[model samples]
Target: MMKAKTRKPKAKSKGKETPKQIAKKLEGIGDGMVADIKKGKDPSFKTQLRGRSNVEFDEDRGILTLGDKETTRNFLNIGHARKFMQTTMVAAKTRDYLNQNKTASIREVYYELKHTVPNSKENTFDGQTESDAVIVDLEHSVNTIREKLNLHANPKGTLYGDITLKDKMHHNDKFNCAKLGRGGWSVMSRLEPEEIEIVSVNAKYVLVIETEAMYERLVEEQFAKKNHCILVSTGGQAARGTRRLINRLNSEKKLPVIVFTDGDPYGWYIYSVIKQGSMALAAHSQYLACPEAQYVGMTLHDVETYGLENVTERMKDGDIKRAKEMLEYPWFKNKLWQNQLKKAIREKIRIEQQALANKSLEFVATEYLPKKIKEKDFLP
Candidate 1:
């Protein structure tokens, strides 16, 4: 018989009320004061001094006090006190959120609130510690709500979505094929590398692919059967898990990787992400790129060599424009990227990996895959 399940207790929110909520409550009290004045009576401190008044007028000291216990000894009027209370409340909350959520990035919180909250206004607090604080409690609340509801946390790996049988089967086939290329020997013991596995790949060659579809197709066509090397897919822009895996492949495995991507600005940026690390988090630089990783491609050169003229599509004007701008940018002025940009301009087209599909799986199985394997030189 199954044992009874024990549930864990939820974490209390530390009763930390947001400044907006505090401000709203204080504003209500101020409204009450206005009502009292309009009623032809001096605002009485008697019944108004109930739960957490957050406002006090010290007649003896000629001062007013807002939320904190400390007194502000000089105030012109009730309006001045009210403004102080509102500003103080907002400032205090912003400080609290930043201090408490160290992992919570300001930009992340800002975007989260901007997208999730209606009419959300974002402003930098000019006072001490204000520049770093983001006022996006609504977004933060969504995360708290999800935790309370016991919803599944978002996927943590580089690859997103469910791992299908087809994916696994394809991975298995590639693993087996690579083993065949090296005289039926396997460098990797497992068919599926751990989500964050660190393999000792020192001085080995690593090949990085861009899209899952391409990876799947290449594996299915048995490209690995002709090449004995480590293969990885960026799974998009080196997500946390992907970054970890790449680090392991580089630091532990000691493999130099070569990046193969679509010949577009987005693809070039993706390669830069793996190489230079994402600007979003500057901390991952030493952990991601395999410093020696050169770029191979679905370049304009490939489009012509493969006789895919008709298959090449007109470059989106925006992409071409950005590519030009990127060519001038200091970071992207390298010979490899310049070559890619020049090709994109001269060809007036962008060819996708899918264009290779029309070349027939037989052609991929017999010629292209073999050529790539023979040319593979990422390994030291």
Candidate 2:
């Protein structure tokens, strides 16, 4: 019985091999098996049982799976795979530099890496291979890293560097006239809104005229006495100083503003500046343009409606061309421009605010300003 009680056969250790390990061993044994198969030698029974049919062979499926799938492919055998890895490492280092410098470009990264690699090979991979495959792989890796890290491409080459929307807003707030006064006017120099003096403020409304000539005429004509609104002249294009002053008037004084301008494109753009900041500049959009201000104008329609046909001047070819081009602009293609352009095409004329001066100081002072104030329609 003791002799029969031999140690129970050692339990077979069913330790399972990982897919990666299995793949490696299969790859190692595959070359010899494939050579044997090529030589027309029948695989041994044991090899056959083990499913070894050829070198570098796939047992589960006959399909070749090598040098393609990134996760499975060996970097040494596949040029693209090796390049991809190298590019990834370079991109990581570049990203680190970008985090510190914040103004690195693709070209800069390429040159920097090229300098670090031996022989200063600009296009070649490790100075041995000349293939765009590596550069392409590097670009792909950089893009992937950018997506994963939520990093923005530094395309602008800005001085403060790659800034976010929040950064822009923060910078805008710092430069705000309300915060820094007219002394910080440099920030808003780009907007170019008219400058007007805050002559008086009662409560009802704010009146802004486009040109200084109009302001002088209104004052000389005694229009200020009739209309109780605060009068200010956006002294042409609304300069930086003017914008700062307007900001103070609107925010601190809390006055609802109305713009009076000529019916031409330039005047329309000026009125737009007071209402919805100018598009030409980038920084002053948020601070200078008051979204709430309304436009009250000397429009093309007023030329006909007011029986001022004699005052209407012939439209220049330049004016017509500009009007047509306005159709392509986002804001100008609306009903406002459509009506204006149709009138311009039909009448073949353009009207200026100065033409309204002929209506006599009494007519303009009494009828014109009152009608605009009541109707709340900025454009004629």
Candidate 3:
């Protein structure tokens, strides 16, 4: 048999960053583009794309990762020119925002660039997608992620916890999460940990609830205060801000994190994104995932365990498809998760986090959660 040739890996850049490296990086990108224009040369850029086929899970690191391939954008290429132009415009706008010490959402970036080009029907950006991709590109190119470029995506998720911090950006005053009333602080906005200092904490662990309703119930019951823990809700799928807070809590505060979600593929996915990161935003895993986080309940076994038979809904075709697809994923190949998926297929049913309500509103918080935490019943 003939031997197959194996290619060597590309060597990485070895330069270390100096002080004000970020500011210089932003300036360098813009300066290069201007130099290209001055020389009558078309501009170009590259970004690592995230897709199902290209995403892989690093077992040791416990986060999804991108492949070696890169997507290129050049002004001379008709197919990519418009987006390339939009990206450069976005970078320029972000530079201004950063210089001025301000932030703007992806939507704002769209509107800021949504204007007709001179003597042309084409607009700088027809929709938000054009600008959004550009921001992700910036994240990869600059080797930094955050809205300091004045480029930010719409923030998602909220947090209630036993953390006390000072907001240096706005009020420059101290605030405690435990002291907040029923409504906790809105963490959907950009969470600059440096600005919000943690003064004191009563939490031994952090509980990330899947459903907003359950989170509100826990908040109303003063769950974090009573249990001496941090309570967080992503509202649905874990968002960037929500994940950042969880990762910060786990890595920085040395806190154990537990997640509660329904017994379904989507719910399971929520847990996966927190524990092992997701395919879409895998590149930003450093701040967006807490691989140490674990899932507690709402598994197929929980259906029988909790007697949630009546509340169980029939699993749809899509639900089954998602579960089967998850079985093939490297990170989800463990026997526990495989069995959980097989059980769901055999049962042909799905249950929501709200199904815990069948017992009582407080059953999840008081009975289910405490027992799970004590037993250390979590899926890694």
lDDT of candidate 3 over 1-380, digit per residue (tens): 11112234223331234224656787888788788889999877877765665566666677776566687778899998888887778777777777677778778878878999999998887777777777878877876675445455566776787687677777877787766777777775566564456666778899888888888988887778778889888888876767877887888788988898888998998898898777777666766788888888788788888888899999998989989888887777888999999888888899988888899988877888888788987776
Q: Which candidate ranks first by TM-score, i.e. highest?
A: 3
When 1 and 2 are scored with TM-score, the better candidate is: 1
**TM-score for each prediction?**
0.49, 0.46, 0.89
User: Candidate 1 — which residues are off by over 4 angstroms?
Assistant: 1-204, 362-366, 376-380
Winning candidate number (lDDT) = 3
- Model 1 per-residue lDDT tens digits across residues 103-150: 233333333233222364523333323322212121122212111111
Local error of candidate 1 at 76, Å?
A: 21
User: 299-361, model 2: which lDDT tens digit per residue?
Assistant: 787876788888777877877776665555444445876787677766767777767877875
The model with the greater lDDT, 2 or 3, is: 3
What global local distance difference test value does model 2 have?
0.47
Off by over 4 Å in 2: 1-200
Compute the lDDT of residue 350 as modeled in candidate 3.
94
